[model samples]
Each structure stands twice: as structure tokens, then as C-alpha cells.
Target: MSKETRLREEIVTVGRSLHMRGLSPGSSGNISARLDDGWLLTPTNACLGELDPGDIAKLDWEGNHLAGKPASKEAFLHHAVYAGREDSGAIVHLHCTHSAAVSCLDCLDPHSALPPLTPYFVMRVGRLPLVPYHRPGDPRLGEAISGLVGKHSAVLLANHGPLVSGKTLEAAGYAIEELEETAKLFLLLRQQPVRLLDEEQIEELRQTFGAQW
Candidate 1:
């Protein structure tokens, strides 16, 4: 199979996993992987649970459709991240339940959306900033994401959802999963007196595993 074919199949597999695990539902998430010439993105309004690999949209670096179904309206989200973060090979944007719930909360830190609760969250998701609200499919949201892309691989959109980028499609997949689970834990423990990973411990993780924090 060609590289593009492999990526399409992988995107389908990952999307299906997200849907099955309740991380993506309805037509609420979009995914994309970088290609040599462009990108392979899930089609607009397509259910992540039922993605057809052959119908995955292909687009150039400039976000123009090249083949397959029409690209997700959030194509510019992928475009912005890839342009800003050369290391990102895949992007996953989702309205998973817990992450979306966190987005709706009013008091989250704009610079760091989630507190460091788990070491894996710190390692996989790093620093997750929360982007300001924008209506679905709004192209202007890309500019906000791009502005927050310096060291962050993930961001939670206010009243929206989370967008994550990683070095590979699988990496992005894993990171988003971690984000979702961590978000869930954050909500569950929100009322309790929780001992978060302190700066010293977080520093150890950064020194030992290169955690993003």
C-alpha cells in the first residue's frame, strides 16, 4: 500500500477507536495526518465511528482539496498547527465529553487548560492551553491555535473541545486519549483537596522523560 493509503487506514482505525471508547461521538471529531505532498483528513460531518478510508479527503499544504471527499471545515486547524509545529505529523480535534465539559467551565487558566494530575498527562499532552471560544468551522480559530503553538501540542477550545497534535498519527491519538481521561479525572476530583504534581515533581518528569508540562 502507498504511504497515503497507510495513513488513511490508520486514521480510520484511530477514529473508530475514539468512537468506540466514547472519545468521539456523532460527527463531532476530525482527524488528519501529514502526507509527503499534503494531508489526509477525515471528511466533513463524517462520523468518526464510520469513516471510510477510501473517502478520506486529501489536501495540499495550502488547505486546498486534492482528492477524496471534501476536507473537514476545520482543515485550517490542521493547517495552522502543521505550519507552526514542524514536528507534528497528525492532528486530532474532538468534542469528547469530559474535555468539552471542561471547556465550558468559566475559570480555567487560559495558558494551561488542565492541571498536571497524572505523569502521563504531563508527558503526552504537555502544556494544554485553552483557546477562546469560536463557532464550529470558524477559520479564524486557526489563528488562535497558531498563536498558542509555540510549545503546546494541545489546546482546549472554550465552549468547544480539544485539539491535539503529535509526532505521528498514533502519537496524536494517544495524547488525545490521555487528555480526555485526565480531563475526566480533573472533574471528578474538582471538589476534593487534591495534591497535584508539584513543581519539583514536574521538573523531575521533565528531566527524566522530557515531559511537556
Candidate 2:
């Protein structure tokens, strides 16, 4: 198979995995992977569990549709991240229940976001910013992500979902899953007065993993 063909298959495979794992339901997520000439993305309103490789949409770097099915309505957000972050090769956004529930709470810190619940989270996700709420497909949502593209690998859209980007689609999906797991842990442990990792431990993990900000 050609590179584009392989990417399309991979996107569909990952999309099914996300849906099956309950990261997204009822077409509530979107995914995209950069291509040599452009990009391949999941179709709009399509159930991720049933995606076909041939139906993945193609778009130019400037967000122009090049071929295949209509792209996800929220494609602009992915484009914004890719445009601003040169290292980004794939992006995934999921309406995972735990993460979305956490986003609704006003307590999330905008700066040092996504508490360092575990060393893996600190190493993979780093700080996950909480972007202010915006209606789905609102152009302003893309604008908001554009500001944090270079700094954050993942962000929680307030009351909506989490968006994550990485050097590959698998890496992006893994990071988003980590975000959801961390959010679930946070919610579960919030009432127990748990002792989080100290700054020294966090720094040690960061140094050991060479975590990028």
C-alpha cells in the first residue's frame, strides 16, 4: 500500500480502538495524521468504530479539501495546531467521559494544568491546559489552541473534550488516553485527600525522561 493508504488504514484502526475503548462515542471524536503532500483525517459525523480507510478526508496544509469525504467539522482545530507546531505529525481529539467531566469543573489550573498524578503522565503529557469553552466547530476554538500549540502537547476543551498532538498518530492517541486516565484518577481520589508527588519527584521524573515542555 502507498504511504497515504497506510495512513488512512492506521487512522481508521486507531479510531476503532478509541471508540471500542470508550474514549469516544457516537461520533464524538476526530483524528488526523499528516501526509507528505497533505493530511488524512476522519470523516465528519462518522462513527469512529465504523470508519473506512477510503472515506478518510484529505486536505492541504492550508485546510483546503483535496479529496476523499468531507473532513471533520473540527478539522480547523487540528490544522491550527499543525500550523503552529512544526513537530506535530498527528492530532487526536476525544470526548472521553472522565476528561470531559474534569473540564467542566472550574478548579482546573490554567497554568500548571493536569496535576502530576503519575510519573508517566508527567513524562508523556506534561501540563495539559484547559482552554475556555467554545461551541463545537467555532473558529475561535482553533484560535485558542493556536496560542498553546508550541507549548502544550495536550489541552482540555472546557466542557467539551481533550485535544492531543504528537509526532505520530499512535503517540497522540496514547497521550490522550493518559490524559483520560489521569482525569479519572483525579476525580476518584479528590475526596480522599491524597498526597500528590512533590516537586522534587516531579523534577526527577522530568529529568529522567527528558520531557519536553
What's the CA error at residue 148 for candidate 1, in Å? Answer: 1.0
The best candidate in terms of lDDT: 1
Stretches of candidate 1 off by over 4 Å are none
lDDT of 1: 0.91
Using TM-score, give the best candidate's number: 1
TM-score of structure candidate 2? 0.96
TM-score of each model, paired residue for residue? 0.98, 0.96
Off by more than 4 A, model 2: none
Q: In candidate 2, where is summed lDDT lowest over 10 consecutive residues?
A: 204-213
Instruction: For residues 1-213, write the lDDT of model 1, one tens digit per residue.
Output: 999989999999999999998888899899999989998999999999999998999998877888999988888988999999999999999999999999999989888989989999999998889898888879899898888886799999999999999999999999999999999999999879998899999999999999878
lDDT of 2 by residue, 106-213 (tens): 878986556887887888888888898999989999999899888988888999989999999899989999888999999998868777778898878768887754
lDDT of each: 0.91, 0.88
Error of 1 at 119 (Å): 0.6
